[model samples]
Structure formats: C-alpha cells, structure tokens
Target: MSGKLYLKDKLVDEELDLSMMQLTEIPVKEIEQLGSKVLKLNLSHNLLTCVPANLPLLTQLTSIDLSKNQIVELPENFGQLTKLKSLDLYSNQISKLPVSFAQLKSLKFLDLKENPLVPELAKAAGPCITANDCAKGFF
Candidate 1:
C-alpha cells in the first residue's frame, strides 16, 4: 500500500510524511502535486537505495528526513535545495558528499550518523554523532 501522511500548521502550508512505508522509491509525481506548498518531507525507515534525481525541483522544501534507509548517496544536484535548513540522513550507507553539496549555503542542521564515510572525508566530517556535530562538517 502507498502510505502517506499530510500535515499542516500555522507556519507551514503542507508537509509530506511517508515514514515506515517500506518504499524503495519516492513518489515524485505525488509529491510534486503539492508544489511549493510542501515544506517538510519524511521518508525515514524505508528501503530506499537512492534519492530521486529530480529532487532539486522541489525548491520549497526546508526540512527532509531520509534516515534509517539503505541509501548510498544523494542526488547529484542536491545542492540546489538552497532553501533547505534541516536534513536527516542517519543510518544510511552514504560515504561522501558530492561536489555540489558546497552550494547548500542555507543549510543549518545536518545529521550523518552511522554512515560509512572514508577516513579522509570522515576526518573532515568529524564525529557525526549529532545534528549539531554534522553541521560542523560543512560551512
């Protein structure tokens, strides 16, 4: 079944929560339906192997939770989420950030716990033990 949860509050017009859906992929079309109204997206606790390549189109997103998945890497154009502030990637197989990641100037919080990053990158990343710690890895 395609599980979906929609939320809204005074601050946000819309949010899409698809946690624990056992999904291998994100329903881009369905998500696109909400357009710029969507701000937060939750895809944690699934079996996703990769993030959607077209994720950069959702420029309105501010927060995204992609934790507890099998994802190995993020979309090449992930840096296009210039408005994004918070990102959770806990317990994934990600090793390194893409070159374009440096473009995420608006990012304020990041979580990269449990990822198997290479020693060189890990040293640069430091202890990704918490969201605060992960934020230190980047500018």
Candidate 2:
C-alpha cells in the first residue's frame, strides 16, 4: 500500500514474514507496542525515511530487516539493543552513524551495503567499509 498501517497489540511470536509486500511506510510506534516479545522483524522493501524511535523497546529483538528503505540516520539509542545479534540495513539512505553504534557489543552480523560511507565514522570504526569489517576487527 502507499500509506502506513498501525496494527497494535498483536501478539506475533512466530516468524512474521512480510517480504516483497510492496509496503511503502510503517508507523513504528504502534508496531513496537504490539510485539513486546517479538524476537525477529522483517521490514524489507518499504519506503522508510528514518529509524523508528521505539525500536529499542523491543528488548527481545535479535534480528531486524530494514533493507531497501530511505532511512537517513539511526537513533543514538540504536545501540541500546543489548540483545540484538543480527541487523540488516542494506540498501538504505544512511549517510552517517552515531558514535554510540559501537556500543552494540552484542552485534555479530550487520549489513550496510549501498549506503554512503562517512570517512570519519569509517575511521572511527577502524577502516571498516561494512559491519563485517568491524566484526572482523579489520580496523
């Protein structure tokens, strides 16, 4: 759809796959409150502009897919996802990352392909072109 949908208070514990749904936008706030115990989320192929503020509240979230969106910046609190292990942000509009991102010690796999690279942040992340670079300690 061209518009956004707000489906709150829905208990979706099993894998909820919405791949290739042609969804343009999603209201993150309403979705966060619904899946309090959700461990994985897939929002690929949407027309998002920014990372959702309430994302970190999904304490159980270990994997998230935000590929092919228009996200330009990530929230500083994005690092607060201590339980997060895998994050997919491929093909977005992110130009720079918050320094706080390094705090995600639990992060094991991150994808940042097709996004602009901030040299300074890349330097801070230690010569890593992708999260794989950081994960491999290439810096």
* Candidate number with greatest lDDT: 1
> Positional deviation of 97 in candidate 2, in angstroms?
1.1
For candidate 2, write residues 42-69 as lDDT tens digits: 8888777887667676667788888888
Global lDDT of each candidate: 0.81, 0.69
- Candidate 1 overall lDDT versus native: 0.81
Q: What residue pairs clash in candidate 2, if any at all?
A: none
